[model samples]
Target: MEKVNLVFGTVYGSAQFVAETLTSKIAELDFETNLIQSSDLTGFVPKEDELLIIVTSTTGQGDLPDDIAPWFAEMKSAAPYLPGLRYSIIGLGDSSYETFCGAAKQFDELFAELGAKPLTARLDIDACETMEPETDAVQWISTWHSAAQSLNQ
Candidate 1:
């Protein structure tokens, strides 16, 4: 079975809720899914066959959540090459903020810089537009799953 690493960072837990909601959906698609907190990962590198899904919510002044900042910084400092990795990002933020989904954008850029290929376009869920980000995120998983399966075929 293919594997999905669902890594998430949350401030008040919205992102974590979204990630947890997707886990069952991912399993329904027959992919083995692992739900991980961003802070829990250390010196992590993606395997070629693994799919990485990053779900993050921006915090104060468009910064990564406290739990994820150190991990992201470490990854940046390591700057490992990731040409074989395929991934996607789900960003949750308010459009009214100057840096809406800024953390996710930063992650996307960093992944691109490290040569990680995106499985699909990033999904940005605006707090101003929706009360339930998990709903939007859940809808996106099917599309992302299709893209992941396509690569294997």
Candidate 2:
């Protein structure tokens, strides 16, 4: 009965917005879900049967938001083996930054090293672009839904 959980890390709040929208949309699509922020996680780990979707916004210099940095550092150091975890990430950032989406890239890599399986490719949504910020995320979720529905997470 493990549900899909949406974990977001935001500085200026764009990632939170995206996470909220995704939570609503995913619920509409009939999946049980939970939305959690970085500060909300303290000794949190997904059950072996759970799925996770991470949406994070890079802060200064493509750094992980201060709230989430410690968690990532801990995870990296601990290297928790989540062999049954399935996840995907949507990264928000401005393309102008030299390290655009660096945090997300790091997280994605780190998760793999921890033995989590990716449901789809990591998506980078550039706030600098003219398109709506959530457009790509929405589309990616739709595409992923069909594919993921057929598989066990």
Candidate 3:
């Protein structure tokens, strides 16, 4: 079975919750899924066959959440080539902020810089627009799921 690494970075747990919710949906599509916290990725790198799904929330002044900052910094310093890796991102933020979804945007750029292929466009869930981010994320995942499957063929 294909595998999916559902990685998350959360401030007040919204991103974590969204990641968890997506896990089941991913499984329903017949992909084996693993839930990973961004902070725990010390020497981790996604294998070519593995799909990376990042769900992150921006924090203070458009900064990455504390748990993910170190990992992001490490990746920036290392700049590992990942041309074979495919990934997607879901960002949670309030549009009222000057840098809404900034952390996710940063991740998107970093992944691209490292040569990872994006499975689909990033999903940015605005706190001001929706009370339930998971709903919007779930809807987006259907499209993501299709895109990922196409990669196998």
Candidate 4:
């Protein structure tokens, strides 16, 4: 019965949609889900019973979305000290861009640096792909959920 936190760092709102879907799916699996933007992460840390899921998109020239800038910096510096922060990530970007899914990659690296264990591999989606966003998210979540079930043990 642990809480699941779905954090979004979105630019064009695509990432937000993915976060919402993730929240709903987690709820269906019987876990409490808190949907928040990455900006809200500053100074607020979840407890050990919480699971964090990040959905982020790379903005212009591979920058994080406006809201996540501050949190990103703090997390980068503080990650190594974080306690019991198990997490997963889904990054959206256009592979055609020079920095494909840069934001997602950054967060993944930060979480790893901070000692957070990933429930699943970071799922990276290319914007130019023919697959719909929802489909990609659903696929990733299905795999993630299976992996996450073992996390609370």
Candidate 5:
């Protein structure tokens, strides 16, 4: 089975919680999984054939979190060719913010610019709606995985 790499960028830690839940769920699906903060991008890179899942939150009026901004900045500056990457995103933000899920949206665009393909539509969860993050992700992840698996064949 291909490994699943889960990355998160969070200000108040909600994204991390979501990532953990996703990691557990993905493992239950029998995929080897690793959950890490966006800052840990240096630790590993998802191969062209692996699945990448990103969970990020907009911080301080649509900015990346402190721990992740630097890493994302590096990625933007470096802009490594990643035409082979297949990924999905779950962006967490307050709908009240003008830039709801801004960070995640930014990354989604950046990934495309870097030549990565989005395996599915990015899931935008509005915290302002009192949505349950874990529950939403659990359901979405299952559906996303099913879609990815089918496409893989």
Candidate 6:
């Protein structure tokens, strides 16, 4: 069975909740899902057969959550190779900010630069006041799984 890993860097717990809900939905679809905090992804890379879903939130000035700053730095600097890996990103931010979901955007670009293929288009969710991140995440993952299955055929 293919696995889908959910890595989260959340502030104010909203992003974490979003990640968990999405992981649960993926598991319901029969895909193995691993939920990991961004701080704990050291030396971690998804297997070629697995997919990675990064759920990250923007902080002050559109920075990554404090817990995930190190991981972001390492990915940007070391550029650890991930071949044959497919991934996607969901960004949580306030649209009121000049750089909404900027952290997720950066992560998406970094993964692309490192040669990881995106299994789905990135979803940038505005804060809860305007849009529901959880709902968008669920729909996006469903679409991603279907696309991935089709691609594998």
- For each candidate, how many residue pairs have backbone atoms clashing (under 3 Å)? 0, 0, 0, 2, 0, 0
The weakest ten consecutive residues by lDDT in model 1 span 37-46
Worst 10 residues of 4 by lDDT: 74-83
Question: Can you list the residue pairs that collide in candidate 3?
Answer: none
lDDT of 6 by residue, 1-153 (tens): 688888899888878989999989888888888998766787676676788889999998989998777888877888867768899899999888898999999999899888899888888988846456788788787688887787669
Give the per-residue lDDT digits (tens) of candidate 5, residues 78-152: 888899898999999888889899899999999999899998899999887756787888889867888778865
Model 1 / residue 58 / CA error / Å = 0.4
TM per candidate: 0.96, 0.91, 0.96, 0.90, 0.93, 0.92
Report the Cα lDDT for residue 129, model 5.
73
lDDT of each: 0.90, 0.83, 0.91, 0.82, 0.85, 0.85
Ordered from best to worst lDDT, the candidate numbers read: 3, 1, 5, 6, 2, 4
Off by over 4 Å in 6: 128-131
Could you give me the TM-score of model 1 versus the true structure?
0.96
Instruction: For candidate 6, report its TM-score.
Output: 0.92
Q: Candidate 5, which segments miss by more than 4 Å at Cα?
A: none
Please provide, for model 2 over 27-116, each residue's C-alpha lDDT reduced to its tens digit, 9 standing for 90 to 100.
888788899877778777766677798899898887898777888888888788998888989999889989999889989999999999
Count of backbone collisions within predicted model 4: 2
1 against 2, candidate with superior lDDT: 1
lDDT of 4 by residue, 1-153 (tens): 778888888877888998998889879889889998665688766455688888898998888898777888876666546557778888999999999999999888888777777878889999799456757998777787777777756
Worst 10 residues of 6 by lDDT: 127-136
lDDT of 1 by residue, 1-153 (tens): 889998888999999999999998899989999987675688766676799999999998889998778878988999988899999999999999999999999899999999999999999999999999999998897799789879978
C-alpha positional error of residue 77 in candidate 2 after TM-score superposition, expressed in Å: 2.3
The whole-model C-alpha lDDT of candidate 6 against the native structure comes to 0.85
Task: Return model 5's CA RMSD, one decimal.
Answer: 1.5
